[model samples]
Target: MSDPRTPRPTRNEAPQWQSEDGSLILAKCEDCGEPHYYPRVICPFCSSDNLSWITCSGRGRIYSVSVFRRAEPPYALAYVTLDEGIKMMTNIVDCDLDAIRIDDPVAVVFKDRNGIPTPMFAPVQG
Candidate 1:
Protein backbone atom coordinates (compact mmCIF):
# COMPACT_ATOMS: atom_id res chain seq x y z
CA MET A 1 0.00 0.00 0.00
CA SER A 2 1.57 3.20 -1.16
CA ASP A 3 1.10 6.23 1.04
CA PRO A 4 -0.66 9.04 -0.75
CA ARG A 5 1.26 11.49 1.42
CA THR A 6 4.54 10.47 -0.14
CA PRO A 7 5.48 11.60 -3.58
CA ARG A 8 5.96 9.03 -6.27
CA PRO A 9 9.49 8.07 -7.11
CA THR A 10 11.19 10.63 -9.27
CA ARG A 11 11.28 8.88 -12.59
CA ASN A 12 12.68 10.35 -15.74
CA GLU A 13 9.38 9.39 -17.30
CA ALA A 14 7.23 10.94 -14.58
CA PRO A 15 4.97 13.72 -15.75
CA GLN A 16 6.50 17.16 -15.36
CA TRP A 17 4.20 18.35 -12.63
CA GLN A 18 6.23 19.87 -9.79
CA SER A 19 8.76 22.55 -10.50
CA GLU A 20 11.76 23.84 -8.53
CA ASP A 21 10.10 27.21 -7.97
CA GLY A 22 7.47 25.68 -5.67
CA SER A 23 4.42 26.15 -7.85
CA LEU A 24 2.59 22.90 -8.59
CA ILE A 25 1.57 21.58 -11.99
CA LEU A 26 -1.61 19.58 -11.95
CA ALA A 27 -3.96 17.81 -14.29
CA LYS A 28 -7.17 19.50 -15.29
CA CYS A 29 -9.96 17.36 -16.63
CA GLU A 30 -11.09 18.60 -20.00
CA ASP A 31 -14.40 16.85 -19.63
CA CYS A 32 -15.46 17.91 -16.16
CA GLY A 33 -13.23 20.95 -15.71
CA GLU A 34 -12.03 19.55 -12.40
CA PRO A 35 -8.42 19.84 -11.37
CA HIS A 36 -6.74 16.91 -9.63
CA TYR A 37 -3.64 16.61 -7.51
CA TYR A 38 -0.98 13.92 -8.00
CA PRO A 39 -0.28 13.47 -11.66
CA ARG A 40 -2.12 10.72 -13.43
CA VAL A 41 -2.61 9.48 -16.96
CA ILE A 42 -6.39 9.80 -16.71
CA CYS A 43 -8.88 11.86 -14.75
CA PRO A 44 -10.01 10.03 -11.63
CA PHE A 45 -13.44 11.59 -11.76
CA CYS A 46 -14.78 11.14 -15.24
CA SER A 47 -12.31 8.51 -16.35
CA SER A 48 -11.46 10.76 -19.25
CA ASP A 49 -8.02 10.60 -20.73
CA ASN A 50 -8.21 14.22 -21.81
CA LEU A 51 -6.16 16.13 -19.28
CA SER A 52 -4.02 19.22 -19.41
CA TRP A 53 -1.10 20.14 -17.20
CA ILE A 54 -1.32 23.57 -15.67
CA THR A 55 0.29 25.48 -12.83
CA CYS A 56 -1.92 25.94 -9.84
CA SER A 57 -2.05 29.15 -7.79
CA GLY A 58 -0.47 27.13 -4.98
CA ARG A 59 -2.88 28.58 -2.46
CA GLY A 60 -5.54 26.57 -0.73
CA ARG A 61 -7.63 26.09 2.37
CA ILE A 62 -6.85 23.31 4.78
CA TYR A 63 -9.61 20.77 4.55
CA SER A 64 -8.20 18.63 7.31
CA VAL A 65 -5.13 18.44 9.53
CA SER A 66 -3.11 16.06 11.67
CA VAL A 67 -0.10 16.59 13.92
CA PHE A 68 2.60 14.03 14.53
CA ARG A 69 4.75 14.62 17.56
CA ARG A 70 6.85 11.47 17.54
CA ALA A 71 9.18 12.42 14.72
CA GLU A 72 12.56 14.01 15.29
CA PRO A 73 11.04 17.24 14.09
CA PRO A 74 7.36 17.20 14.82
CA TYR A 75 5.26 18.24 11.85
CA ALA A 76 1.75 18.99 10.73
CA LEU A 77 0.18 17.21 7.79
CA ALA A 78 -2.92 18.14 5.96
CA TYR A 79 -5.28 17.66 3.09
CA VAL A 80 -5.43 21.00 1.39
CA THR A 81 -8.01 21.80 -1.22
CA LEU A 82 -6.25 24.17 -3.59
CA ASP A 83 -7.99 27.24 -4.83
CA GLU A 84 -8.22 25.33 -8.09
CA GLY A 85 -10.48 22.81 -6.35
CA ILE A 86 -8.09 19.96 -5.90
CA LYS A 87 -7.30 18.38 -2.57
CA MET A 88 -3.72 17.21 -2.05
CA MET A 89 -1.87 15.50 0.77
CA THR A 90 1.01 17.66 1.93
CA ASN A 91 3.02 18.63 4.98
CA ILE A 92 2.55 21.99 6.64
CA VAL A 93 5.69 23.82 7.65
CA ASP A 94 7.13 27.17 8.78
CA CYS A 95 4.38 27.66 11.34
CA ASP A 96 3.71 26.48 14.82
CA LEU A 97 2.34 22.97 14.64
CA ASP A 98 -0.53 23.66 17.02
CA ALA A 99 -1.70 26.68 15.09
CA ILE A 100 -2.76 24.89 11.94
CA ARG A 101 -6.41 24.06 11.68
CA ILE A 102 -9.07 23.28 9.15
CA ASP A 103 -9.83 26.26 6.90
CA ASP A 104 -6.41 27.75 7.44
CA PRO A 105 -5.21 29.43 4.27
CA VAL A 106 -1.92 28.08 3.01
CA ALA A 107 0.61 28.73 0.30
CA VAL A 108 2.92 26.23 -1.32
CA VAL A 109 6.66 26.37 -0.82
CA PHE A 110 9.51 24.27 -2.10
CA LYS A 111 11.47 22.25 0.41
CA ASP A 112 14.44 19.99 -0.08
CA ARG A 113 13.64 16.33 -0.39
CA ASN A 114 16.41 13.79 -0.95
CA GLY A 115 18.41 16.60 -2.59
CA ILE A 116 15.44 17.47 -4.75
CA PRO A 117 12.97 20.31 -4.30
CA THR A 118 9.53 19.22 -3.20
CA PRO A 119 6.32 21.17 -2.66
CA MET A 120 5.17 21.75 0.90
CA PHE A 121 2.48 24.02 2.23
CA ALA A 122 2.81 26.61 4.92
CA PRO A 123 0.37 28.90 6.63
CA VAL A 124 -0.22 31.95 4.52
CA GLN A 125 1.12 35.10 6.08
CA GLY A 126 -1.50 37.69 6.86
Candidate 2:
Protein backbone atom coordinates (compact mmCIF):
# COMPACT_ATOMS: atom_id res chain seq x y z
CA MET A 1 0.00 0.00 0.00
CA SER A 2 1.14 3.50 -0.65
CA ASP A 3 2.03 5.63 2.36
CA PRO A 4 -0.75 8.12 3.05
CA ARG A 5 1.83 10.71 4.00
CA THR A 6 3.10 10.80 0.46
CA PRO A 7 1.66 13.70 -1.50
CA ARG A 8 -0.62 12.98 -4.41
CA PRO A 9 0.62 13.62 -7.94
CA THR A 10 0.09 17.16 -9.12
CA ARG A 11 -3.05 17.71 -11.12
CA ASN A 12 -2.84 18.83 -14.73
CA GLU A 13 -5.75 21.21 -14.51
CA ALA A 14 -5.79 24.42 -12.54
CA PRO A 15 -6.86 23.98 -8.95
CA GLN A 16 -10.28 25.22 -7.92
CA TRP A 17 -8.59 27.06 -5.12
CA GLN A 18 -5.21 28.61 -5.68
CA SER A 19 -3.24 30.89 -3.41
CA GLU A 20 -0.59 33.11 -4.88
CA ASP A 21 1.07 33.55 -1.47
CA GLY A 22 0.91 29.91 -0.29
CA SER A 23 -1.76 30.58 2.29
CA LEU A 24 -4.01 27.72 3.37
CA ILE A 25 -7.49 27.33 1.90
CA LEU A 26 -10.06 26.21 4.42
CA ALA A 27 -13.56 24.82 3.95
CA LYS A 28 -16.16 26.32 6.18
CA CYS A 29 -19.74 25.23 6.68
CA GLU A 30 -22.29 27.93 6.08
CA ASP A 31 -24.83 26.12 8.23
CA CYS A 32 -22.68 25.38 11.30
CA GLY A 33 -19.97 27.95 10.75
CA GLU A 34 -17.17 25.49 11.58
CA PRO A 35 -13.94 25.59 9.59
CA HIS A 36 -12.19 22.43 8.53
CA TYR A 37 -8.98 21.52 6.75
CA TYR A 38 -8.59 19.16 3.80
CA PRO A 39 -11.47 21.00 2.20
CA ARG A 40 -14.40 18.84 1.31
CA VAL A 41 -17.62 19.37 -0.60
CA ILE A 42 -19.59 18.32 2.45
CA CYS A 43 -18.86 19.58 5.93
CA PRO A 44 -17.43 16.88 8.16
CA PHE A 45 -19.02 18.38 11.24
CA CYS A 46 -22.57 18.95 10.08
CA SER A 47 -22.81 17.16 6.76
CA SER A 48 -23.81 20.42 5.15
CA ASP A 49 -23.28 20.99 1.47
CA ASN A 50 -23.06 24.75 1.98
CA LEU A 51 -19.33 25.03 2.17
CA SER A 52 -17.14 27.88 1.07
CA TRP A 53 -13.41 28.48 0.84
CA ILE A 54 -11.61 30.89 3.11
CA THR A 55 -8.01 31.89 3.58
CA CYS A 56 -6.41 30.51 6.73
CA SER A 57 -4.46 32.54 9.22
CA GLY A 58 -1.65 29.97 8.92
CA ARG A 59 -0.80 30.24 12.60
CA GLY A 60 -0.94 27.23 14.86
CA ARG A 61 0.74 25.22 17.61
CA ILE A 62 2.36 21.83 17.29
CA TYR A 63 0.19 19.17 18.90
CA SER A 64 2.57 16.27 18.45
CA VAL A 65 5.76 15.41 16.54
CA SER A 66 8.06 12.59 15.59
CA VAL A 67 11.57 13.13 14.33
CA PHE A 68 12.84 10.71 11.72
CA ARG A 69 16.44 10.42 12.78
CA ARG A 70 17.13 7.68 10.25
CA ALA A 71 16.32 9.92 7.31
CA GLU A 72 19.43 11.21 5.54
CA PRO A 73 18.98 14.81 6.66
CA PRO A 74 16.47 14.23 9.46
CA TYR A 75 12.92 15.58 9.42
CA ALA A 76 9.89 15.96 11.63
CA LEU A 77 6.27 14.94 11.11
CA ALA A 78 3.83 16.80 13.23
CA TYR A 79 0.13 17.41 13.83
CA VAL A 80 -0.58 21.10 14.16
CA THR A 81 -3.63 22.60 15.84
CA LEU A 82 -4.57 25.74 13.96
CA ASP A 83 -5.92 28.79 15.68
CA GLU A 84 -9.23 28.20 13.89
CA GLY A 85 -9.55 24.80 15.60
CA ILE A 86 -8.48 22.66 12.67
CA LYS A 87 -5.67 20.15 12.98
CA MET A 88 -3.52 18.95 10.08
CA MET A 89 -0.59 16.64 9.60
CA THR A 90 2.41 18.40 8.09
CA ASN A 91 6.15 18.40 7.99
CA ILE A 92 8.09 20.77 10.22
CA VAL A 93 11.15 22.41 8.69
CA ASP A 94 13.79 25.12 9.00
CA CYS A 95 14.71 24.54 12.62
CA ASP A 96 17.10 22.55 14.79
CA LEU A 97 15.88 18.99 15.11
CA ASP A 98 16.80 18.63 18.78
CA ALA A 99 14.83 21.68 19.82
CA ILE A 100 11.36 20.86 18.49
CA ARG A 101 8.72 20.54 21.17
CA ILE A 102 4.98 20.02 21.41
CA ASP A 103 3.00 23.25 21.44
CA ASP A 104 5.73 25.18 19.68
CA PRO A 105 4.22 28.04 17.74
CA VAL A 106 4.42 27.39 14.02
CA ALA A 107 3.55 29.16 10.78
CA VAL A 108 2.74 27.77 7.37
CA VAL A 109 5.29 27.86 4.57
CA PHE A 110 5.28 26.38 1.11
CA LYS A 111 7.83 24.14 -0.54
CA ASP A 112 8.00 23.77 -4.30
CA ARG A 113 7.19 20.24 -5.41
CA ASN A 114 7.47 19.59 -9.13
CA GLY A 115 5.96 23.05 -9.79
CA ILE A 116 3.24 22.62 -7.19
CA PRO A 117 3.20 24.45 -3.86
CA THR A 118 3.25 22.07 -0.93
CA PRO A 119 2.36 23.31 2.50
CA MET A 120 4.66 22.77 5.47
CA PHE A 121 5.21 24.32 8.85
CA ALA A 122 8.15 25.87 10.64
CA PRO A 123 8.78 27.41 14.02
CA VAL A 124 7.63 31.00 13.90
CA GLN A 125 10.54 33.40 13.85
CA GLY A 126 10.40 36.37 16.18
Candidate 3:
Protein backbone atom coordinates (compact mmCIF):
# COMPACT_ATOMS: atom_id res chain seq x y z
CA MET A 1 0.00 0.00 0.00
CA SER A 2 1.18 3.49 -0.74
CA ASP A 3 1.94 5.73 2.19
CA PRO A 4 -0.66 8.41 2.57
CA ARG A 5 1.83 11.09 3.54
CA THR A 6 3.97 11.05 0.46
CA PRO A 7 4.39 14.41 -1.27
CA ARG A 8 3.68 14.62 -4.96
CA PRO A 9 6.64 15.58 -7.05
CA THR A 10 6.59 19.07 -8.47
CA ARG A 11 6.56 19.38 -12.22
CA ASN A 12 8.64 21.76 -14.28
CA GLU A 13 6.44 24.68 -13.55
CA ALA A 14 6.01 27.40 -10.99
CA PRO A 15 3.72 26.55 -8.15
CA GLN A 16 0.37 28.26 -7.90
CA TRP A 17 0.73 28.28 -4.13
CA GLN A 18 3.95 28.78 -2.25
CA SER A 19 6.18 25.77 -1.75
CA GLU A 20 5.74 24.13 1.63
CA ASP A 21 9.45 23.46 2.21
CA GLY A 22 10.30 26.80 3.80
CA SER A 23 11.75 28.08 0.58
CA LEU A 24 10.85 31.37 2.27
CA ILE A 25 9.71 33.12 -0.87
CA LEU A 26 7.27 35.92 -0.38
CA ALA A 27 5.87 38.72 -2.47
CA LYS A 28 7.12 42.18 -1.63
CA CYS A 29 5.19 45.16 -2.84
CA GLU A 30 7.33 47.44 -4.95
CA ASP A 31 4.98 50.28 -4.15
CA CYS A 32 4.66 50.18 -0.35
CA GLY A 33 7.50 47.83 0.62
CA GLU A 34 5.26 45.30 2.30
CA PRO A 35 5.90 41.60 2.35
CA HIS A 36 3.08 39.16 1.82
CA TYR A 37 2.82 35.40 1.96
CA TYR A 38 0.71 32.85 0.03
CA PRO A 39 1.77 34.49 -3.19
CA ARG A 40 -0.85 36.68 -4.77
CA VAL A 41 -1.41 38.47 -8.05
CA ILE A 42 -1.78 41.78 -6.24
CA CYS A 43 -0.47 43.21 -3.00
CA PRO A 44 -2.96 43.11 -0.19
CA PHE A 45 -1.39 46.03 1.60
CA CYS A 46 -1.59 48.73 -1.04
CA SER A 47 -3.45 46.96 -3.88
CA SER A 48 -0.43 47.07 -6.08
CA ASP A 49 0.43 44.59 -8.83
CA ASN A 50 4.05 45.64 -8.55
CA LEU A 51 5.34 42.65 -6.62
CA SER A 52 8.26 40.33 -6.71
CA TRP A 53 9.16 37.11 -4.96
CA ILE A 54 12.19 37.13 -2.74
CA THR A 55 13.87 34.39 -0.77
CA CYS A 56 14.44 34.87 2.92
CA SER A 57 16.59 33.29 5.56
CA GLY A 58 14.86 30.32 7.07
CA ARG A 59 16.23 30.82 10.58
CA GLY A 60 13.78 31.72 13.28
CA ARG A 61 12.95 31.40 16.97
CA ILE A 62 9.98 29.94 18.70
CA TYR A 63 7.68 32.81 19.56
CA SER A 64 5.13 30.60 21.30
CA VAL A 65 4.16 26.95 21.39
CA SER A 66 1.75 24.44 22.80
CA VAL A 67 1.89 20.74 23.39
CA PHE A 68 -1.17 18.91 22.29
CA ARG A 69 -2.07 16.27 24.81
CA ARG A 70 -5.66 15.49 23.96
CA ALA A 71 -6.08 16.49 20.37
CA GLU A 72 -5.78 14.59 17.09
CA PRO A 73 -2.72 12.43 17.69
CA PRO A 74 -0.99 15.14 19.72
CA TYR A 75 1.71 17.29 18.19
CA ALA A 76 3.54 20.49 19.02
CA LEU A 77 2.36 23.63 17.26
CA ALA A 78 4.23 26.91 17.37
CA TYR A 79 4.41 30.43 16.17
CA VAL A 80 7.92 30.91 14.89
CA THR A 81 9.34 34.39 14.46
CA LEU A 82 11.26 34.34 11.19
CA ASP A 83 14.45 36.28 10.62
CA GLU A 84 12.47 38.54 8.31
CA GLY A 85 10.38 39.57 11.34
CA ILE A 86 7.40 37.58 10.17
CA LYS A 87 5.70 35.26 12.60
CA MET A 88 4.54 32.05 10.95
CA MET A 89 2.52 29.22 12.41
CA THR A 90 4.13 25.84 11.86
CA ASN A 91 4.88 22.51 13.43
CA ILE A 92 8.14 21.90 15.24
CA VAL A 93 9.74 18.64 14.22
CA ASP A 94 13.00 16.63 14.54
CA CYS A 95 13.18 17.25 18.30
CA ASP A 96 11.56 16.18 21.50
CA LEU A 97 8.67 18.17 22.88
CA ASP A 98 10.55 18.51 26.16
CA ALA A 99 13.33 20.25 24.26
CA ILE A 100 11.04 22.86 22.73
CA ARG A 101 10.98 26.25 24.40
CA ILE A 102 10.12 29.83 23.65
CA ASP A 103 12.98 31.82 22.07
CA ASP A 104 14.87 28.65 21.13
CA PRO A 105 16.63 28.94 17.83
CA VAL A 106 15.24 26.85 14.99
CA ALA A 107 16.11 26.15 11.40
CA VAL A 108 13.89 25.15 8.55
CA VAL A 109 13.46 21.52 7.53
CA PHE A 110 11.38 20.47 4.60
CA LYS A 111 9.13 17.49 5.11
CA ASP A 112 7.04 15.72 2.49
CA ARG A 113 3.37 15.78 3.23
CA ASN A 114 1.27 13.83 0.72
CA GLY A 115 3.84 14.65 -1.94
CA ILE A 116 4.02 18.33 -1.07
CA PRO A 117 7.06 19.69 0.71
CA THR A 118 6.01 21.31 3.96
CA PRO A 119 7.99 23.72 6.09
CA MET A 120 8.93 22.53 9.55
CA PHE A 121 11.50 23.56 12.12
CA ALA A 122 14.07 21.82 14.25
CA PRO A 123 16.45 22.86 16.98
CA VAL A 124 19.56 24.60 15.73
CA GLN A 125 22.46 22.34 16.44
CA GLY A 126 25.42 24.02 18.08
Local distance difference test values of all predictions, in order: 0.79, 0.80, 0.75
Worst 10 residues of 2 by lDDT: 9-18
Give the clashing pairs for model 1: none
What TM value does model 1 have? 0.82
For 1-126, candidate 3 gives per-residue lDDT tens digits of 776544343331135234655565656789999876556678878999898777778889999999887966678899999888878788898888888999999988877665556777888964
For candidate 1, what is the lDDT?
0.79
Q: How many residue pairs clash in each candidate?
A: 0, 0, 7
Task: Provide TM-scores for the models.
Answer: 0.82, 0.84, 0.75
Q: How accurate is candidate 2 locally (lDDT)?
A: 0.80
For candidate 2, lDDT tens digit of each residue in 1-126?
A: 654544664332124234677777777889999988776668888999897777889889999999999986689999999988899988999999899999999998877655556778999854
Instruction: Provide the global lDDT of candidate 3 against the true structure.
Output: 0.75
Global fold similarity of model 2 (TM-score):
0.84
Best by TM-score: 2
